[model samples]
Target: MDKERLYDELRIFKDRHFLQQKLKSPLTVYVLLALSYLLITILFAVALSRVSVLSSQLNEMRKELKRNHSSEDFKLFPCGPEAREWEYFSGKCYYFSLRMTSWQRAKVLCEEKHSHLAIVNSHAKQNFIMYRTRDKRFWIGLSDQNAEGVWKWIDGSDSTTGFTYWKEGEPNDSNQNEDCAHVWTYGEWNDVHCTYECYYICEKPAPL
Candidate 1:
């Protein structure tokens, strides 16, 4: 009878220990699963935050490019910014001088400005020059500097086949003092003395 009671007590103790161990294992598993879930949630949230930030940066870059494109649209003129005050025509810039100087001095001034005297190569250009001069006279690029009767242009304009706006009975080289040419307000040209002081025009190619 004593042996039977000892066996029963041993069996009950063993069962109690097994129940405790089983309960502890389930609790540990639950804790590990909960921790894993929390870690996954945190990582997903971080990834979303990084994606949102990148999207915002991309949007800002697009806006900057749009602004730059808009600014470039305002610069439409073919001539450069330095020629804003000059007249732009046919890929050339014409500068009307406000000051007066002799023909030789005017040529020197135009050369110093990296340009040459205005050469009227076309009828449209001649009429444009005439309208711009108004009632004032301007010494043009034409001159007989090489020879007395051989009229030439400082800008190397070929007048043999080009148009001429010479006034009536002009270029007679009156009294041997008329070698340089000047344009009057009527668009007609007259040979004048080189020492005569007058307004002038300068011309140069416009920037592409």
Candidate 2:
């Protein structure tokens, strides 16, 4: 009878220990799951923060790049001597008139613009003017209006001592009325009537 009682008590104690161990296991597992969730949330928040910082940095870099590009462009192309409708080349600024007018009117217009008619004194200047004039008959600064058979530049320089590209058999005083010299398409000079309408070129020294 005593032995039976002892065995019963031992079994009861064992069962109680096992139930306690099972309850403790479930609580530990729940704690572990909560810790894992907290860790994942922290990691996600850190990743989002990093992404936002990177985006802000990238935007700032783009703005800085644009500013630098604009500054460099300004440095490369500063204010030149040429104004609107003028082209700068070889220490001079030239204006090619789009409309045709009489040689005297063209000269006046150039003077009004603070310039003068084109005074080509070298082969290089003539070629440059011709290239721009193209096929158009553009009036230059050469003429014998002062004295027939005595050609002179607008600046009063003698034409014979400078440069002259007269076309073959040009300045022949055709009809006794051709006194003004104009450039032909082939970079040659021709004597045309001063009243004849033609495109013209203006020249001025480039500001230092």
Candidate 3:
């Protein structure tokens, strides 16, 4: 434990074979580390690019699948030749036929089947019916039978602002006797006495 002996031991420890092993050059080690880091960055960038491209392709494929499936679904429920046809877009069923009955009778028939006569709303819907019927005449729900000249749909909908595809000057109560409305050829509308029978169209909300 003398100072001279302690210094001699320290020197011996520093000069040992293990401690004398050649050390790595700091500059060379740093250069190798930098090169490895750059390689890793490049690899990561390539991997990210590939992943992005794959993700985009997957998204596009999903969209195409949805489009195809939706079209197929629509085709499964087509408008058939039944007295009532379903309108998928509106979730409603429509009946466009020529059965000629009084407005009250038509309403009663519709109610019995859990529906009411057709209520023409938009021009688009009227045109849609016309096209489906091949421009044939059908009765709508509108009528002024209660108080002549005050037309209203079965649902109490005011047809004043509604698109009236009426035949020109036809609802003039021609004989001052017309009390019912009916769709005519060319998608035009006309008024007739309720007693005069004509084909009618009925509409109902689709059952849930």
lDDT digits (tens) for residues 1-208 of candidate 3: 6999999988898877444443366676788799999999999999999999999999999999987876665566533323325553366777655566777788788788777888878877777777766655566788887777888887887788776778887689878778888887787888887777777777876543
Query: Residue 126, candidate 1: how far off, in angstroms?
Result: 0.8
Predicted candidate 1 versus true structure: per-residue lDDT over 99-158, tens digit per residue: 999999999999987889988878999888988998688988998888767777896655
Q: For model 2, how does the per-residue alpha-carbon lDDT over 6-93 read when each residue is reduced to its tens digit?
A: 9999999999998788758978779878999999999999999999999999999999998787666534433242365677667888
Ranking by lDDT: 2, 1, 3
For candidate 3, the 10 contiguous residues with the lowest summed lDDT are 77-86
Q: What is the TM-score of each candidate against the true structure?
A: 0.63, 0.62, 0.57
Off by over 4 Å in 2: 1-82
- Judge candidate 2 against the unseen true structure and give its global Cα lDDT, from 0 to 1: 0.86
Runs off by more than 4 Å, candidate 3? 1-75, 78-89
Task: Give the Cα lDDT of each candidate.
Answer: 0.85, 0.86, 0.75
User: How do the candidates rank by TM-score, highest first?
Assistant: 1, 2, 3
Point to the candidate with the largest lDDT.
2
Kindly give the stretch of ten consecutive residues in candidate 2 with the minimal lDDT sum: 73-82
